[model samples]
Target: MIVAIIDYGSGNLRSAAKAFERAVAEADVDARIRVTADADEVAAADRIVLPGVGAFADCRRGLLGLPGMSDALASAVLEKGRPFLGICVGMQLMATVGREHGDHPGLGWIEGEVALLPAAGEGLKIPHMGWNDLRIAAPAHPVLAGLASGAHAYFVHSYAFVPADPRRVLATVDYGAPVSAVIGRDNLVGTQFHPEKSQATGLRLITNFLGWRP
Candidate 1:
């Protein structure tokens, strides 16, 4: 499989590449992964992985400035139905708006907004860091296949996704309240937690994504 890791200059490019590398190593298939700024590579890839780490607005601007990269991604995933997996802030960009940089518009692939994680009672950590359990939603998605409930995964973020459609949320994790953890709609998949850092379970999720038919 050929997986193109979208590079817009704001993502954890090398780390994301390594995660796929590790996952592919465990899987039965041969995978070719690349870190490219080329839009054509994105359009031609079998699957596209979008990873981000930083403010939503800045990342959005970087992607927009990449000439045809943004449109190519949208076309590949939205119109052509190629598999898409977004990680960390990459998942946040799929939402409609984010209050992080004063209400900037997101990719709007999913109807939602990104906001600060609500404080726990009064004084709580802002960026809910460290390992947390996933509350996998029912019917059991292929991404979550073989994964047990309450599976611990690494998380490090302040802003959380607030999905407008509850049905779109695949899994959630609690810090103070339940935050959306995994999201899948047709060919698009997203994770608020860092699957790259989340050990075995996380690596398994990446493996599933790479071998996933849809």
Candidate 2:
């Protein structure tokens, strides 16, 4: 399968590519993971992975700046029903709106808002960085197949995704409160944490994603 890891100048594409490479090496899935900013490649890929860094608006701008890339993404992941995986701000872009810097529009793939994490003071960090335990909502989800409730994943973001539908949240990680860690509806799945940096748990997720049909 052709798995495209989108390169829109807003993420650590090489590192993400390496992570996916490692996962493909360890797993039995025959996936050709390529990093590209080409809209044509994204639309034709069998599986698509979007990795992002920096502010929500900036990332969205970078993505939209690539002419035809947005429409290509819509066609591949939405219209064609290809499996999609979004990481960090890439996942945030899936929300209907983002409150960071200002009210900005998103892809609206998932009915939700990306807002700053509420301050529960008393030394809790704003970025919510480092490793956090994932509390699986349901182990039956294909991408989260083998993940346990306490499986740890690397996170480094201040904003959180509040999905409109509760059923869309597949897993959460406690910061000041339960934050969405994994989310999905149909063929679209996203993670708030960086699976490329999550070590074993991340690799397992990558492997699962490679084998996941939807």
Candidate 3:
């Protein structure tokens, strides 16, 4: 499988590529992963990975100006029916709108809004970092296939997705409230955590994603 990691200037392109490389190596899959800012490469790839680590608004602006990025990505995943996985801010950008940095619009591919995590009590960190367990809601999904409930993944974000359609929420984790962790509808998949930084379990998830049938 050819996996193209979308490079929209959000950084972490190298890390994502290395993570996929390791996962592919471990899974013994004939997967070629590339980090490219090229629109044609994204359009041609069998799988598209949108990885980001920055403000949702900023990321959206960067993507909009990425030549034929939006059209290419939409054609590859939405039109061509290929697999698409989004991580961190990349996932947030999939929402209809984000509350961060004003009420900015998103990709509108998913029915949701990106809002800051609710404050529970004093001493609670805004950016919920470190490993957290996933409350798997959809076990049949290829992304959550081998991942059992309580499977831990590294999370580092302040904003969380509140999917309009509850059925679209595949998994969630409790940092303050039950924040959406894994979200999917058809061939598209997204996560609020950093799978690349989450170690073995994360690697397993990526491997499963690569081998996912859609």
Candidate 4:
């Protein structure tokens, strides 16, 4: 099996690549993981991972700046129904629009808008850094297999994706209020946290994603 992690000039590509490598090895899956910006490679990949860090508009611009990259991704994930994963800003990019630094267009794969996290209460943070517990909304979801509700996952983000349809939310985290932790629909899945940096929980999720048939 071939898994392609798209490096669109954002995020810690090396870290994500290493985590995926470790996950596949531990799972005993014979999968080749490639980090590339090439549209052709992305199109040919059986599974696609899009990892991003930094501003939403910058990430989106970086992705679309590559000639034919967006089209290739759409054809592969949307048209062909290949399993797709988005991490951090990559997840936020899946939204229809982002309100950070003014209105910006996203991939529109998921109907939502990226907005700054509201203040939960006194002593709370803006970036929402550190470990947070996950509440699995869809326990039977393939990507969430073996991951129990209330499992702790590392997170670092200021903005959150508020999906238009509540059914799209697979899991949540309480940061003064409920924050979308995981979102999925059909072949598309995303996490607001960096699964690579999430330690054991992250590794298990990665392994499950590698083996997911959808």
**Candidate 4 overall Cα lDDT vs. reference?**
0.93
Worst 10 residues of 2 by lDDT: 116-125
Please tell me which model should have the higher TM-score, number 1 or number 4.
4
**Can you tell me which runs of candidate 3 are displaced by over 4 Å?**
120-123
Q: Where is the poorest 10-residue window by lDDT in model 1?
A: 118-127
Candidate 1 lDDT over 33-96, as tens digits, reads 9888899999999999888888999988888789798889888999999999989888999999
lDDT (Cα, tens digit) per residue for candidate 3, span 1-214: 7999988899588888999999998889998998988999999999999988888889999987899998998899899989889999888888999999789999999988999887435467988888899999999887887888889899989899899999989999987678899888989899899989888778988998898878
Highest lDDT, which number?
4
- Where does candidate 2 clash, by residue pair? none
Q: lDDT at 10 for candidate 4?
A: 98
lDDT of each: 0.87, 0.92, 0.89, 0.93
Worst 10 residues of 4 by lDDT: 116-125
What is the Cα-based TM-score of model 2?
0.97
Residues 1-214, candidate 2, lDDT per residue (tens digit)?
Answer: 9999999998889889999999988886688989999999999999999999999999999999998998999899999999999999999899999999999999999999998886445368898899989999979998998889989899999998999998999999988878899999999999999999999999999999888886
Summarize candidate 4's per-residue lDDT along 137-159 as a digit string, tens digits: 99999999999987889898989
Where does candidate 1 stray beyond 4 Å?
none
lDDT ranking of the models: 4, 2, 3, 1
Give the TM-score ranking, best first.
4, 2, 3, 1
